[model samples]
Target: MKSLKFLIILPALFLSNLFAQATILNTIAADPESGIYLTAADYKNNQLHLAGNLSTNNKLRLNDFLGSRTLTISHKGQNHEFSKDSIYGYRDKAGNDYRLYKSYSTPYKILENGKIVIYEIKQPGHKQNGFKPLVCYYFSEGADGEIYLLSLDNLKKSFKDQPAFDSIDANFQTDYDLIKYDNYHHMFRINRVLAKL
Candidate 1:
């Protein structure tokens, strides 16, 4: 009886925890005043701009692409599904922008927009000792539009030869330190420092 109760409770707890960690995509808002007409117009006329001077001006509907691992674009009523690997990023009719990082398999929405764009990637962590997945954060600068992996080594390289570099470098020796210092906040803070230089 005790073993039966334990099994039931264990599965319930596991399911609850699993659902708690599920990834939720942010919904981009569209203006209702113009409605579908406006979205269609934008999709038809405006280009789907991507990084590296690439863009697709073909008329396509955004609705055909959402909620799928692959992006399906409609051109002249013909549907085409683009491989995630080939797409670097895309902008929707609502002006919501997304980016695909090389290190990550799927595209992530750009939470913050500026000279640098920030996005998060959730990947499986090292399981040599049986650990769960970990969330990795990344940033891309406007200059190159290349995704730079967020790590202590990359940070040190970025801030190298700058004023007060030694002090800043010493603080982020481990992943724990980076997490404690707030990687998202520090990325912006470091951007400011880079801008000044």
Candidate 2:
């Protein structure tokens, strides 16, 4: 009678464990809609296991605020605190992804993702009337690479080892045109140059 009871309980325990594992894996997509990424790998893999919704109300908004050393995230029915210095970045509720590149705590909106990732960030301009904020562009060789200014001269100087970039200027009229996204190809023009390299 004891042996039969143990056999019956073993299968139930196995099935329970399997279900729990499946839930954990699926939680990335089953969330409250926004999350903090612990690493670049986590962001690249779309793994949002720490699933939570962040409040960016008032002056704490990312676009307006520079950034603080710590970030508090509400997750799993509790408030969890994470250091911006320790984590990669997060995705906003609107589905825009931001990257906390290196020591620059201010998040840079990731505009394009590929072998080379392009980022855009706005800097406050003159507070005078009719002055629009300056829009800046940045790029990184990869998810783990250091971010660099997105300009033809900058790209040429940074990738001195890559000879293929020498012909980059021949393809575009100006640096601005070089950075433009090619809607048909669904990638940045600079990305197309790097792809051939």
Each candidate: RMSD: 11.5, 13.8
Error of 1 at 67 (Å): 16
Off by over 4 Å in 2: 1-32, 52-67, 127-129
lDDT over C-alpha atoms for residue 43 of model 2 = 83
User: In model 1, what lDDT does residue 188 have?
Assistant: 53
Off by over 4 Å in 1: 1-70, 75-78, 83-86, 92-96, 113-116, 123-134, 143-145, 161-187
- Candidate 2 global CA lDDT score: 0.74
Q: Which candidate gets the maximum TM-score versus the true structure? A: 2
Candidates' C-alpha lDDT: 0.50, 0.74
Give the TM-score (vs. native) of candidate 2.
Answer: 0.70
Candidate 2 backbone clash number: 0
In the range 69-96, model 1's lDDT, one tens digit per residue, is 5555544345666654455555644555
Residue-pair clashes per prediction, in order, are 0, 0
Task: Give the range of the ten consecutive residues with the poorest summed lDDT in model 2.
Answer: 55-64
lDDT of 2 by residue, 1-197 (tens): 99999999999999999999999877655544577678889888987646645342211133325556776665555666667778888876656778886664678999988767899998778868357888888888787688988887877777667775676656756768757887889998778777876
